[model samples]
Target: MPHEGEATPRISKVQDRGWAWVVLVATVLVQALTLGFPSCVGVFFKDLQYDFRASNSETSWFPSIMTAVLHAGGCESILVERFGCRVTVMLGGLLSGVGMVASAFSKSISQLYITAGFITGLGSCFSFQAGVTVLGYYFIRRRALANALASTGVSIGLTLWPLISQYLLDEMGWRNTFLIFGGVMLNCCVCGAVMRPVPDKPPGPTLKSCPEQSREGACLSNGSTSCHEEPLHPSKRAACFQTLQKYLAFDIFCKNKGYQIYTIGVSWMVIGFVLPLIYLVPYATLNGVEEHKAALLISIIGFINIFMRPMAGLLSGLSIFTGRRIYLFSMAAMLSGLSNLICAISSEYSVLVFYCIVYSVSMSVIGALIFQVLMDVVEMDRFSSALGLFTILESITILIGPPLAGLLVDLLGHYRYVFYASSFFMISAALFMGLSFCTMEAKNKLKETNKPPPETPSKGKYTEVPTELDHDRNGPPTVVYVTSI
Candidate 1:
């Protein structure tokens, strides 16, 4: 006597439970490792320049090309769907590990580009996206908390990598650092292995288990009279191609207003997002701050971001603020934009640090909620497509942002223009989001006011009798229908 819609025993046995924390740890670890290496690119830039006899632009290819592949290699979502989490991440880990090791042996600038840029970047794309997809599948009620926790890996990586790179540079130099870091990334394979795919639901019973011929009175299977019965019609299965055609959609973005605004805002935000962080060191040095102080600013930014991400998640999950993340994201961006403007005017180290604090919090809010905000706006079923499309869009921005900032610096011979330009872009993105959500809210209110009240369903039987109704109640509207049992 199984309850309707209750998972069958066999199916339930395969469904993993209480392993979500394990999944979270693995996701966090891989993300921390993957992001840690890339964020420390500046440390190796000068060393690379001397070794390869490359120009600033030539050296820039190492990070720019790597980031381009990281963003533009939008294969993670598709692979996640096809190969599942465990394999996709494991493969990514292997590629990334091998790429770093190969980097240690490079002789030319082209070698670094091919190894670090295309090879390592592809690896990161797989590992990063697989980790995110795993989090989404394993947790729903605490999804934001999980995302916040995992995203701390980025800050932690940023914090840790610089110190590690500095130590390695002081001891064994750049080549050996790649050797050391490459060895470190091998742990990602272990992380990937732990991210086992959730098992599928067991198939329904065969004809022999169907009670259709066993008990005539109980076999009223096609009717609603009995709770134990199931519908007797054959359960049709769509062809694989047909199923794919139905589920895979690109036009969903155009149809969804929330997604359109979110995508555009996120794209713009990303276009200038990493620019300030990229210049923090150079900006400080230009104003006569010591190299050590410039490096510590990055550490401070990471320290604050590590704490902010989880806190924002917890706040977003609160009962009072359910389904309103767009508002929070908008405010954070505005504050961050203001901080960038402040940094532009300041020559004092203290004022610069103040701006870093503000920037850290805002950046964390943007990173922590960007994907989650998408999930809230787009239905869960369509998240795969949305993220896939989003990766393609954001990749272009990631490829452009830092270099654009550097270009501004090169053109103006000062850091001020770069900060002002980036701040303007960020502020513009924030305003777009604010107006978009406000418009959405207004539309909802308008629809509520104009729509006719639903007709109440009939009870057993009744003559019409109108009762006094209070339309001013704050709860959902009520419509009363007369009936007699």
Candidate 2:
């Protein structure tokens, strides 16, 4: 028997199959639209450089800034949770669409930076976070597969966007390409509108105080206790406002060794991660591979990634594997690093292509699993806040990683060293994650083997509970209160 709150397979009835399919398709479509722009930047790089007359250094800033803003939007998760998914996402879509439209009118590099990188990135941040968060709540047992399926939108968008952007660039020009894509992005609003809220389990009732009741007595809600208090007075609500005195909650991120492991491993791995993808085509072209052949490499990578993500999810969910998904992910990361290292040494283009295929599979699987690991470390309720803190802290790396890779390429005058360096980073990440996996295994085993760990003193805190006999019975449920001393 599955333990309470342990994940159980929720096989849908045959009659609901059609509705499930609809949800799956709708979710995946929204993710595809949201991710298209960032994933297709490489295709636009050469054109943007030519049009703007920007140096490689400057052009790199465009994508870097865009990625930075996207991560920075993690801070908005508090708002997303408060406002509900539909409204937040629809607003994001509008913002993104407008940003694209603004980008189309840019006449200078700075203008392009502001519109394409900043504004569009902000919109994308909202859409991506909200979509992923919603997916987490909607499905439990199938979350891995659902997330994988949804994430494939990146690859699909990558596939179609590049081809479309290329055609538009040749036929109509970059400005017109942005205009058309901007119109296409307006559909994100429709996507947002379709994302219905996921239902939450009703919590047990809580009372703020029972002053007249004996300490050990249970006070029933049906007037079992007749003591009356002064009529409840409505308290003034604090007006929401933004402030600049932001502080990094380093303690939250640092206190959990698992989160530390995840953060370090991901940051280290990603530093070398995007470098290869970003430069894959250029690397091939420099090696004398034909242009079309080089482009096809990315398509092949994307296709393989499309399959690998769900496969990782499915594999991770299996009970037969001792449920050691993190360990498996560690191995995959190591292999990806090794593949890159080999590719760096290979002179034959076919060998390079083979390496690309292997790396693509590993990278995609790791990407999908990484967030799952994060969810495990931080429960769903705290996920948004943890992710926000992670983003703000990890933004430093996200901002620096690519430009540093570009610098290495410029200095070394080749990308082979980049691969070697990236491999080292990935190896370091793998080793750290392997440690985390071991510690996690030991902890879970201790928890299961009838041994009780020592207890720690509690911190006084309170949480809001939505109280209604049935979760769906009323409008938004009323907030019940609790006290901890």
TM-score top scorer = 1
RMSD (CA, Å), each prediction: 11.6, 9.9
For residues 1-485, write the lDDT of model 1, one tens digit per residue. Answer: 34323433422332224777888889888878876556677666657878998665566667766776776534665565456778888888889889999999999989998887788888977887677667655554455456667777878887877667766876898889998877888788899898765532222355343444333322211111111334455334545443443344356566767777888898888766766766666677668986567667777887887888777766766767566778888888888888888989986899999988888888777776676576667654555556667667777777777667656665666878777888888899999988977887776656657986337411211111222233222111121110000
Per-model TM against the reference: 0.77, 0.75
| Model 2: colliding residue pairs | none
Candidate 2, superposed: residue stretches over 4 Å from native: 1-23, 136-145, 196-249, 320-323, 379-381, 436-485
Lowest-sum lDDT 10-residue window in model 2: 476-485
Candidate 1 residue pairs in clash (backbone atoms < 3 Å): 461-484
Q: Which candidate should be chosen as best, given lDDT against the real structure? A: 1
Clashes of each: 1, 0
What is the lDDT for 78 in model 2?
Answer: 52
- Tens-digit lDDT string for candidate 2 (3-104): 213212222231124344455566577667766556567666767878898766677677777777776654455555456666667777887889899999
